[model samples]
Target: MRTINRTDFLSGLVVAALGAAGLVEALRMPRFEARGADPFTVPGLTPGLLSAVLCVLGIVLLLRGMSGRNLTEGAQPSITQWTRASAIRTLFTIVMVLVYGTLLFGRMPFFYATALFVFVFTVGAELIDTERRLPAWKLLIGGCLLAGGAAYAIDFVFTDLFLVRLPG
Candidate 1:
């Protein structure tokens, strides 16, 4: 009786796949060991947990789609919109992520790489959307603050709490 949105159903499936892949990769990471490592302090702590969360959320989305529930309007973009999104914004984001993870993270100091990645990605994302038309200065400052704060938090969590030395 109810019409299930094909877009949500498909997107849900895609997200679920990505989550599953992340979970598998996380599982392959080194486990907690005897070198002052607690059960919760494994190298895979964050990634593993994050992947599990993603897997759960993706499953929820899949269920929502299958049940013919009204998924968020924004969740299902029009074909033209989707094309534009994928072509520009989404691709840029993917490239940024790859660059940060592969080229920056371990190569440079942790703080520098983290800050650069966050700031550039945030500012680029904001600026790309011509609709919002946010000022450059605001984007820069906000991006800087957000990147700095987030970088600091990540560093503190890894170094102080997890005792993981993110490559400096």
Candidate 2:
């Protein structure tokens, strides 16, 4: 029987706790009955669900690891490392969204704030990575164009079609 790594077990437990916290916060939102508005809607519901599923899976993995079931027995160390990086990136992205939400409430224009976030985050991510450093020009141009386009589209849809006010 293979021994479960302590690191994996603790990581799983941490994720589960975070998921529970998020679920609680999401549930606390007041339901809305406004015409043409889905007040009970949570924007990150899908990702939240996915996070919950992942938490469950992580718990299972931790248990299996404890029970001497080696799920990653044949996996390469590099692959595992990359998986960890991906998880960290996901967490950071969530943090960025939360920051965006806070800024939106402060009367900042959503598009401008979001675009700035994209540019900062993309560049920061590239700078920190140890492998395959992206060219500065590529990162700058790509991030700006993509963020700008997305922000414009979202603003247009909300203002024109939904008749909703966005942070400005």
Candidate 3:
């Protein structure tokens, strides 16, 4: 039987590695204090759950890669398919967030910087894809809505209600 595409295998491996790293980091974090000042707080609530989910996803990807099973077997991806580029795009988002936090946005207001970063990154990623083209107008609108909503929600929860400082 034909093997899975090298790109798929590499992408799965990268995701699995990141997931494993995240799992390790999460495990190393200090234990949640359940008693003091609502230790079951917002920051504590979603990350642990998300970390677990990511670990499961990583295992699944690793298994798929090892099994040599094409994730899109019925609809084989073209050699020039956009998934590879999309993977790079996702990496870009991570890098952007890291840079924003460490270099620029960490000192600024979270809502403003995050909203702009989200819009720029999302729209730029769509624009950079030479294959499987998506329309500019649609990308622009979607990016705006998504970034706006995310900023609003984050601001409402962390800034307004909880009076917590979010990374700019």
By lDDT, who's the top model here?
1
Counted clashes in each candidate structure: 0, 0, 0
TM-scores, one per candidate = 0.51, 0.46, 0.43
lDDT of 1 by residue, 88-167 (tens): 99799889999999999899999999999999999988778768677888888889999999999999999999999789
lDDT (10s digit) by residue, model 2, range 123-143:
767665668467888888988
Best by TM-score: 1
What lDDT does candidate 1 reach at residue 164?
Answer: 94
List the global CA lDDT of all models: 0.84, 0.69, 0.72
Model 2 superposed RMSD (Cα): 10.4
Question: Which 10-residue window in model 3 sums to the lowest lDDT?
Answer: 35-44
RMSD of 1: 10.7
